[model samples]
Target: MASVALSGKVAVVTGSGGGIGRAVAIAMAEAGASVVINDVGASLHGEGASGSPANETKALIEATGGRAAINTDSVAEWDGAQKIVQCALDNFSRIDIVVNNAGILRDSIFHKMDPNDWRAVIDVHLHGTFNVSRAAAEHFRRQESGAYVHMTSGSGLAGMVGQANYSAAKLGITALSKVIALDMGRYNVRSNCIAPIAWSRMTSSIPEDSPEKKALVEKLKRMTPDKNAPLAVYLASDAARHVNAQIFGVRLHEIYLMGQSRMLRSVHRSEGWTPESIAEHAMPALQGSFMSVQSSSQLIPWDPI
Candidate 1:
């Protein structure tokens, strides 16, 4: 098979200063696509900002003889999102791909979590994806072709214990990507999501040095090693043009495609049942159905039949 290449294409990767975003940006550039690196240099909690990370990534791309530019735009605001896309347009003339990888974590059990924490995570993860993807989708519609990769999470797909806020935002991203895929299909724009598990500064806080931490880290490592950029790069390339409205879980050496949300399920109805008769009979089935329900795993596995 011939190798996939992205020559003459331009890609914008939000949160590209470090971690998966950085890796994806570098990989896309390596595959011959011009890249725009955007990051706010915020901490895991989404605080603070600096220009160093974006600049450093840009330098790395340049050193590798790849074209790139750095944009220190926060994905939280509409203007920032517009500016990030505009940077690509100003420099590269056209945008062929977008990786909406910007995110922040504000983990707290729902009752204990503050409104501010919930809003902050939602603004960054859900609204952030919307901002950037919306901007890029406009340009994509004009050009009649584009690719979008959203950074979702396992927490979002399968809720985590302490990540109520983050999980909600991440899941919302999956929903957004699906809607975009449906809306943009006519424009030849492909939209998908990735539930990635990798070790980065965001996840490094879970002590990997000790035995307890070591086990957890080891489990995570099995999902995706440090270098998990190849899949991301492929998704952002022309090779994945036909893949849309999908969610994938990318880890060390394993790729698990996900299925669609189970919005409805099989039901059995009894004949000639009054309200009381129906209540007694249907209650058990309803409860069983509800209790046995499993959330959709990742968004990447289902092939449209």
Candidate 2:
């Protein structure tokens, strides 16, 4: 197998200034792709912008004999996203991969969540993912070849306490990836989601108010952002040509094929009765399949392998 799995390809990795986004951007370049390091240089809270971080990433790639260009447009905006895509075309002549890894943390308990926070997070995560993906869809369709690797989260797929806004946006990205896969399959364009568990600034923002929360954060420190990079690179490569619309979870060396919405079991009634009858009949049948309201750490309890 060749280490250059993405040779002759061009990839645009959003939020490639640091953390997981930076890691994935470097990995894409190392795999022989001309990369577009797209970052608005916003902080973890989605405020402020600077070009130094993006320039730093570009310098790192160029230092290793890899090709990369800087793109500072905001993924959350329509015209800005098109410009991001256009940057790739202008720099590398074409694009073959798009990694939607740009996001921000605006966590708040449901009732306490400000509408402003909700809109900001959604604008960057949900609408941002959609805008960039939609902009690239045209080129992908015309070329009849492309791959999309979206960054989803365990917070959304499983559950979290203070991130109503973030959770909704991440889960929405998964659904968006699925729909994009369905809509663009005929064009030979693939879309998929990666729910990665890694220690980054995003995870660092978690409050350690409890012993259990503190312990979980300590364990997460062992899972570096680079662990998720190889998976993104593989999914973007020709080697994963047959994979589509799938959700993958990466924890250290473990790679899981996460399950999608599927019916475990179903029951039917000849004639429906009152609500009291539904409690008697449906409750027992469904209770066995009910999943616990557990956080991602609670579900994956042991230290990552």
Candidate 3:
């Protein structure tokens, strides 16, 4: 089979300064795409900024003879996102792919969580995604071709304690990607989401010197951002033009497609039923399919593979 190539293509990868975003940016460039590496160089908690990370990533790409430029704009802001897209047009002329990989973590127990924490995470993960995607949509629609690869998470797909804010935002991105896929399909635009389990500063929250944490780190070492990058690159390639509106998961060597929400089973009644009748009839039918109330970790209790 012939290898997938991105020659003559241009891509924009938000949060490309480090981790999975950096790996994806480099991979896209290696695949022959001119890339816009956008990153404000914010810390994991979305605090502080530095230009070094974006500069280093740009340098790395250039060192390998890959065409790339850096944009230190916040994707959370509408104007900043427009500038990021404009940077791509200014340098590469046209954009063929957009990878929304930038996000911040603000984990806290739901009841005890601060409103500011919730808003901060939502603004970055959800609003930032909208800002960039909306900016690119106009160009993609005019060109009649584009691909969107968004970063989602297991925290949203499954469930994670102390991550209500992050989980909600991640899940919102998944839905947004799906809607974009539906709306842009006719224009040859594809949008898909990936819930990846790879180590980054975000996962550094796992305390050191614990057995579970040690196991997770070992597994993550093998996983790497590189392992996850190929999938993003593939989604952006011409080969995956037919693949859209899907949720995928990458864990170590495992790559799986996730099933979205759907009715598992249904029951019908000859006539309208009261609350008592619903309890008597519907409860029994749905009981067998009911998942446990506990979160993913509480149910499985295993380290990342």
Candidate 4:
């Protein structure tokens, strides 16, 4: 049987101080990869920073006899991201994999959402992912092989209430990952996105007494961050070299291969028809394919699994 190992590889994982990021960074190290643990130690809303998160994560890896380093740079800024990438080169000598898992949430109904709320989430998730990826591109190109594991969310893919900013940013990341895969595929660099459902600081907001929350909590007992790390580790390894430009989801006991957007139905006319004719012809043809405007909650109506 073929084994999945990252021996001799160097990886940088953003926002790895805790939660999914921490799990991923540690997993990479356990796979024999040297790791750069990057985390600014920001609160869930992206406010304030401390070095404890990154330092603690690094210590955890070191305790397990794995080579690791801590970085407190924010990925939201171009220079900060550059410094993070450079940290890997300076410490590990080369870069092989990057996991962009840094993010924050600012939920609000779209109409009532504040402009600042929208911008802040976009800056951290969308722009942050771009910044880190850009910083690593040059090094990855020089090395001729690299892999990116970008974190997305159900809020973006399936749509959720009160997550206007978060959803938009996460969805943007999905698109961005695909483009990076396309642009860097020829150079043997691959990129893929994951929408993870886990119990973490990010998910602590669920109402404690709700049935949905209880079920989700029960589901998470089995689908821990530890369990979610394998898929990311696989994506970063040579075994999945050909798996690029894809979207996946990790739920309790299942791994989902998600679908992308495409034309479900279409109608054509020999000659350009008036709006009236098209409305009648196109609407009739596409009626069967029309999807209901239900939010993520309505569609799943269950726990994380």
Better of 1 and 4 by lDDT: 4
Residue-wise C-alpha lDDT for candidate 1, range 1-305, written one tens digit per residue? 64679999999999989988998898899999999999999898988999899988899999989999889888999999999999999999988999999888877767899999999999998999999999898889998999998989887887766678888999999999999999999999989988887877667666567895687665654443235678778887777878899999876666878776775545466566578866887666566556333433333243222
lDDT of 3 by residue, 1-305 (tens): 64578999999999999999999999999999999999898899999999899889899999999999989999989999999999999998999999999988888888999999999999989999999999999999999999999999888887888999988999999999999998999999999999887778777676658887687667666767878899998999999988999999888777889889898898888997789988999889889998776754454355455
In model 2, the worst 10-residue window by lDDT is 296-305
**Runs off by more than 4 Å, candidate 4:** 217-222, 301-305
Cα lDDT of candidate 4 equals: 0.89
Q: Write the per-residue lDDT of candidate 2 for residues 1-305, one digit (tens) a residue.
A: 74438889999999999989999999999989999999988889999999999999999999999999999999999999999999999999999999999999988889999999999999999999999999999999999999999999988898798989999999999999999999999999999999998899899987899997798888889999999999999999988889999999999899998888888887778886678877999888889999888976677766776
Clashes of each: 12, 0, 0, 0
Q: After superposing candidate 2, which stretches have Cα over 4 Å from the reference?
A: 2-4
> Residue pairs in steric clash, candidate 2?
none
| Model 3 per-residue lDDT at 170 | 92
Q: Clashing residue pairs in candidate 3, if any? A: none
Candidate 2 residue 252 C-alpha distance from true site, Å: 1.3
Best by lDDT: 2
lDDT of each: 0.84, 0.93, 0.89, 0.89
User: Which numbered prediction scores highest in TM-score against the true structure?
Assistant: 2
Query: Candidate 3 at 170: error in angstroms?
Result: 0.8
